[model samples]
Target: MALKKLDKDTIIAMVLVSPSILAVLIFVYGFIAWSVRVSLSNWIGLLPDYEFIGLGNYLGLLKDPRFHIDVRNTLVFTILFVGGCLFLGVGLAILLDQGLRGESFFRSLFLFPMAISFIVTGVVWRWLMNPAMGSRMSGLNLLFDSLGLDFLVNKWHTTPNWGIAAIAIPAIWQMSGYTMALYLGGLRAIPESLREAARVDGASEIYIYRRIVLPLLWPVTLSAMIILGHISLKVFDLIIAVAGKQVALDVPSVYMWTTTFDGQFYGRGASIGILLLLSVAVLVIPYLYQTLREESTT
Candidate 1:
């Protein structure tokens, strides 16, 4: 009778969660499998007519210098992007958590970016960072030039290192807010008594935060890192909108889109997509495993 009741309750709980579970399985897992299948087959154009090409696509992807650059660019972007967001986000969260007045207002301001779409963010940043026509150029650049500083107007997005940073600005703007919100929530969840005890012990604010708060916020950091990593990996729309159709700014996702559609290298494009998936898995699986293990132990 006890086992039966337990089983009944389990079934009821599963039923309650089944809708979300089913949705994830259908949309995420199913699509991943389908994409993998497509990658193995040579397909292109309006309708996908798949021809089995074994590992030809993969071999081509390996040799493509553009793809290799895309991979390297992606790695660099992910590192810098994730690092900046977390540092800014957690720092902002900690500052805001100090029982400052107008907390909600500041919180909302920080979160405002989360409300804006990345597409819009990219467009705005593109205009701001434009070589000649951006508002920043006309507004600030003109002011600088008026002061006889013509060097500052010399094309912000054309330089190599700075060009990548220009693309990263929009991404950071859109994501940092979301990350700040997460860290803020984590901060609020920290026990008030712990802070009080630290205060009583005469621990400096920096020391308390570094030793106590940050250790606890590790989980939040990990979660945010994983989420941002995935986002960075699949970044496409922003790159395309800002950089354009061909692979000039050439991240893997943008490059893959062009190779498949523009260059008619469907096999190679699919392989690139597969490689992207692999990169995501490489980053995510370990993070998730550690999270899971920690959860299980705790």
Candidate 2:
């Protein structure tokens, strides 16, 4: 009788979750398998033509100069955006940790930008960083002129060669708050007595942070890096909102968009999509492994 009840409960539990599990299997894994099949085919036209040209699209991208530029832009954007977020996030977290006057108000002000979408940020910053000169000079250029600080004015996202790097500005601005929130949680989890103990031992505040606090925040930092890494890898909508598909600021996601949809190179687009998926997986899988391993050990 007891065994029957246990089996019945197990069946009920499976029945409750089976629909969601089946949905994920069919919609997520099923679509991924379909995309992989599409990527390997010779389907470049509007219609589906699965001629089985394995790795051809990937190989072509290797020799493509535009693709090379895309890769380089991605590298530059990812480094600056991720690094800036980490730096500003941890700094804001440490500042708030000090319990300054009107801390709640300041914390809200810092995190307020995170509430807005990246598209909104891109649009706003585009005007603020408008690169036009002379009569067309407005936004930051106009403001800088008013303040008599000509050197402070810049072409921003229009700067040649490093234009893509400027794109990281809005990204970092929007995300640093989220990173700060993560680090703040990590900082709070650390017991206050530990800092007191270090102080009693004649350690400076900076020494305590370097040796104790920062070490404990490593997990948080790693988590933020993975999140930001994947985000930087697949940046699309934000770039569109800011730069409007210019070649100088192009990244893989934008190239993929134009290549697949606008250009209708279906197979090539699928390949780009697949490569992007792989890049994100490379960041995510390791984090998942570490998290699961720690959980199992505990």
Candidate 3:
């Protein structure tokens, strides 16, 4: 009777979860497998061609100059975007942790940007960072000119080689608030007694932060880095809305979009998609392993 009851309960549990399991199997993993197969095929047109081309597309991407630019742009954008968010977020979090007046209002103000879609942010910022000079100047340049800071006004997103870096400004603006929330949560989780104890021991606030608080926030930082890095790697709509398809600011996502959808190079597009998946996995898998290991140890 006991064995029958246990089996019945297990069957009920499986039945409840079976729909979700099947959906994931069919939609997520199924599409992923299909994409992988597509990536290896010589498919290039309206009709599906499953002729296996092995690693040819991947090898072609390696030699492609446009892909190389995409890599460089991605690196520059990622570094600036991640670093700016971390710095600004940490600074804002620290300021807010001081029990400031209207703290709730300020927190919401900071996080409000995160609520806006990246596409919307990109559209707004595109106007703001307009690179026209002289009478044609507007947006940020106009503001600079009005302030009599003529030297500060220049072509922003069109600024050659460093054009990709300009995109990071808007990216940082949109996401820094999220990073702040993460850091703020980490900061609040810390005990007040720890800071008091450090102060009583004649340590400066800076010393306490550097030695104790910062060390404790490493996990939060790591999590933010992984999340930010993944977003950076897969950036598409933001760049599209801001700079269009300009090669100087092109990242893999943009390249993938053009190659796959615009040019109808499905094979190359699928290959780019796979590379993106692998890049995200490279960041996420290690974090997952570390998290699971910590949980197991705990």
Candidate closest to the true structure, highest TM-score: 3
TM-score of 1: 0.81
Worst 10 residues of 1 by lDDT: 133-142
For each candidate, give its TM-score against the true structure. Answer: 0.81, 0.95, 0.96
- Candidate with better lDDT, 1 vs 2: 2
lDDT accuracy of residue 26 in candidate 1: 90
TM-score between candidate 2 and the true structure:
0.95
Scored by lDDT, the top model is 3
lDDT of 3: 0.93
Candidate 3 — which residues are off by over 4 angstroms?
none
lDDT of 1 by residue, 1-298 (tens): 9999999999999999999999999988987777777778877665776787778778777787877777777877788789889988998898888889998898889889888777787777666666764454564456667799777765555566446555776788788988999998899899989988999999999999999999999889989999998999998888776667645467988887777888776666777887888989998999889879989999
- Residue 172 displacement (Å), model 3: 0.7
* lDDT minimum window of 10 residues, candidate 2: 102-111
Ranking according to TM-score, highest score first:
3, 2, 1
Q: Which residue pairs does candidate 2 place in steric collision?
A: none
Off by over 4 Å in 2: none
Residue 205 lDDT in candidate 1? 90
